[model samples]
Target: MPSPAAPAHPAHLSPALTLLLATATGLAVASIYYVQPLLGLLSAQFGVGSASIGLLPTLTQLGYAAAILLLSPLGDRFDRRRIILWKAAALVAALAFAAWAPGFGALCVASVAIGLMATLAQDLVPAAATLAPEAERGKRVGQVMTGLLLGILLSRVAAGSLAAVAGWRAVYGSAAVAVAALMPLLWWRLPRFVPATQAGYGELLASMGRLWLQHAPLRRAAMAQGLLSVAFSAFWSTLALVLAGPDFGQGSAVAGAFGLAGAAGALAAPLAGGMADRRGPQAVIRVAALLVFLSFAVQAVAPASLWLLVAVAVVFDLGVQAALVSHQSVVYSLDPASRSRLNAVLVSGMFVGMASGAALGSSLLAAFGWRAVPVLGAVAALGAVVVSRHGRRA
Candidate 1:
């Protein structure tokens, strides 16, 4: 059963609040990804082996998965505004710590903290759903998610360009400053959220397990999205390494520019959301997964061609992101009051897949070659397609 409904809220979210939510989500989530484009530079600076450098992203994703499971559900039991504020402050500090870390080990520790605090972005998504009217929920969530997807894509571009000019430390330092500035603005403009449930923390968590078992749609959404995330993470976590190899001999700046190709994919979020609102998310999932599989398959065969890789990136990123919006639409509709916990379960699965992909992709890239990375992605995308095909309808 749906937990007691949240106190009735406004039927529509204002434009200004929507933009604030989007901006906040984007900036918060960007912290986890800023290191990706800089992996090669970090490898050289920290004197770590290429394969070991992959551990940074792996640890970050692991930390994120842990936090999503542990902390994200707190939004339902407490005022989401308070949770967002507290996490934002910690995120700022973590980013600063990462900027000044004197060694790779310290940097890795800081990366975990960055991931933990970045759950603020996840908080904002449920908050958006809580605020928007039922009729507009899909569109509103899509808008905020567009900010999130852009932040994930553009952070690479920004980090690469900034690191190229001022060095990697400056990239983290600038992120710290940007997030710090946003906090006061968020505080000033964001409204307080009424706690959706009065359950104690332990009961609240227990309820999540009940929710998972109670809804087949929730389980399917999590499984399909998690599988898609494996492909998404594998491609991104290894792209810099691929570009740095003799096949391309490109630098971080060039690898970061490839984020531009992925940015094109962000356009799919609102489109997918609108489509889901009209036609339902299931069809969208099937088509989007196919796009991802095809994109990765092509890249696996022609890994050496930069132009082909860029084109494939655009297609696969679009597929991955579109599927995410559709999955969220399905999950959010599961239980109105349980949106936070449901989101936690869904996104936790995604980051687990991310952690796995980073670990697996790095190992494959090291053992086999760049071709192997996309092959892994192709296989994972195919699995997602299979899951969508076999699963119960959302």
Candidate 2:
């Protein structure tokens, strides 16, 4: 058989294909996170605690993990367009359920459903890379990645503002409408390729065990990204709590502004993509860890300083986004045929990392208070930097 084609340079992609995937990524990835900024409102409507409101993201993440672990292999076994289409439809249903949810219990169920359905993005990214000309895979993937980052960072601000005005259900309802409208277009526009494996779900999941044993890079990327995510989670998950507290005593609108100001973080995608294109992904991780460490350190000093928070947000976002993009770039290089499964491993690990960090930050605040939280995050990134320097963190 002919050898598989080599991956291409960023400049190799046609602008049209890159733009299409980027647009689709913005729409699809946003669906997965529309609930993040709405958690406060959802909690009020259902009457839950911070830790319980925490479960909104936690359960959604768990559902995402399950989909990646269980469903992503189908991309290798079946037609990807159909999988994307079906998952989008399922997502619409889930979002609708969330919109009309009557109580906390129903909301949790809907969030899980949405999380499971939204893993279509896992399949979508692999499909984008697979369809790209080999030479431009990184560039093309970077374009889509910009959309992913934008959706992730902006959704908090966007959803928060919209949630305040129209209510959380309205925010989800609007997304559901957009997702439902886009499904047919996606089903039509996506490219086609033959499936690589027809393994059953059990067999596909078993492949992950083998994957874990064989790929050192995959494991390392997961660790590096996971730690970086924990650092990020430390800030985002508690920003509202701190802002809403006595010192700042700010409202959600103020808290949401941080998300917008932090948009600078997404700017690093191109830089990270370029770095991975040149020096190799390890270099990107090293720099990202250092930046993340600085971001946390800056926050430690800037307790009531908006300007300082903004500066740190920029640094922190750059570190997190760069590390994230670089991590995905590495994983894409490893296995072209089963990226969804690989994504399942990587994305789920990231959420768990964030969840762990968020939990840790909350507990620290409860005991040592908010002043101590940034120090913990700084220590996390610094620790990663040390580990990376030794060639162990990856």
Candidate 3:
């Protein structure tokens, strides 16, 4: 019998179909990130402090953690398509609530719900991993990952750009329709996976702990990605502030343009994934770390130049997406029996890092100034780089 990881490609599925689904995945997940770039505007409109506005993002992160904590393990228990459909349903509801949200408090409540619902992507991933053909899993997964990363990067602009034209509420309202439209396509196109009927939730939770304890690669990847996520989050969390400064004094639309800049790096995600397939994830991680260090170094020194910032954005994004794909490629390979739980653990760590980074960036901006925050960011990026090397060596 041929092994699951054998050399033959799974071209049974159409590339166009796969790419379409992957792009849909990215679009859906991007909903979670739409608010980050708009926090400043939200703060201004809601008459809240920056920290209070920050709650918009904080709640989303926690909600993601909570959803993954509870729902991801279900991937092992039932059809992943069910999980995806249900998640898409909830996302539409969440977007509706966010659209109609009356105040900061209401928006925060809606944000949490959105985050929780958006985590359906976490469940969706194991499904994507399973659908990927054996020999080209990394490349296939990478193609899916491109959409995920695009969702993350592009949604930033979506929020800002939308807010610039209509109101802040309209942006979220539009996401409602987008998510709703996706449900049918996914329902029709996604393949089915037979879930384990044997394991209970308690058993799954226990296994999550064991997965964390027993697998060095999972643990290392989680920590490294978590830290890098914090760095990435910090940059994004304060992007509006930087652009709104005297140097550029840009509006939300102009600020959103930076998302286009970050697209350069997002475009690199599939390349990194394919490379990981050929060279092994360790090499990919090592190379990604170098890119991160270079990007951060540039950010720290060239605070005044928009073109420099744009170039650095590409490098930073490249490092982040490359590192993430590398980690996912490795972790998804562990314990086919519990890939969902593994993803939950790995993604939850990123939530922790994201919340921490947003808070850290906000605090530093309030105290030491925006210029100083990227110094710490550069340090964080370097720290992640070193950690990645140690993980690779060990």
Candidate with maximal TM-score: 1
Residue 188, candidate 3: Cα error in Å is 4.2
User: How displaced is residue 302 in candidate 2, in Å?
Assistant: 3.8
lDDT of each: 0.87, 0.74, 0.78
Question: How many collisions per candidate?
Answer: 0, 6, 1
Q: What TM-score does each of the candidates earn?
A: 0.93, 0.87, 0.89
Candidate with top lDDT is: 1
Could you arrange the candidates by lDDT from highest to lowest? 1, 3, 2
Candidate 1 lDDT: 0.87
lDDT tens readout by residue for model 3, 1-394: 1122332223445676567667777767787788876876887888976656767777787788777777788777876666778888889999899999888788889988998888866765556667677787656766776678778878878888889989778988899988888777766666666676668889988988999999999988888888877777777777777777676677777667788888988786668877998999989987886787777777777748888778877888888878887998889898876676788888888788887787787777667766766776777778777888898678
Instruction: Report the number of backbone clashes for model 2.
Output: 6
| Model 1 C-alpha lDDT per residue in residues 1-394, reported as the tens digit of each score | 1123333355578888899999999999999899888999999999887689999899899999999999887887887877888899999999999999999999999999999999889999888987888888768887898888889999999998888899999999999999889887667666677887788989988988999999998888888888888888888888888899999999889888989999887575558878877878898998899999999898877637889988988998889888988898889888977777888899999999998899899889889988898889889999999889876343
lDDT of 1 at 329: 86
Question: Candidate 2, residues 133-218: lDDT per residue as tens digits?
Answer: 87877677767777777777777787778777777888889888987887755655565557777678789889887777778878
- Give the better candidate number (2 or 3) by lDDT: 3
The RMSD (Cα, Å) of candidate 2 is: 5.1
Higher-ranked by TM-score: 1 or 3: 1
Candidate order, TM-score descending: 1, 3, 2
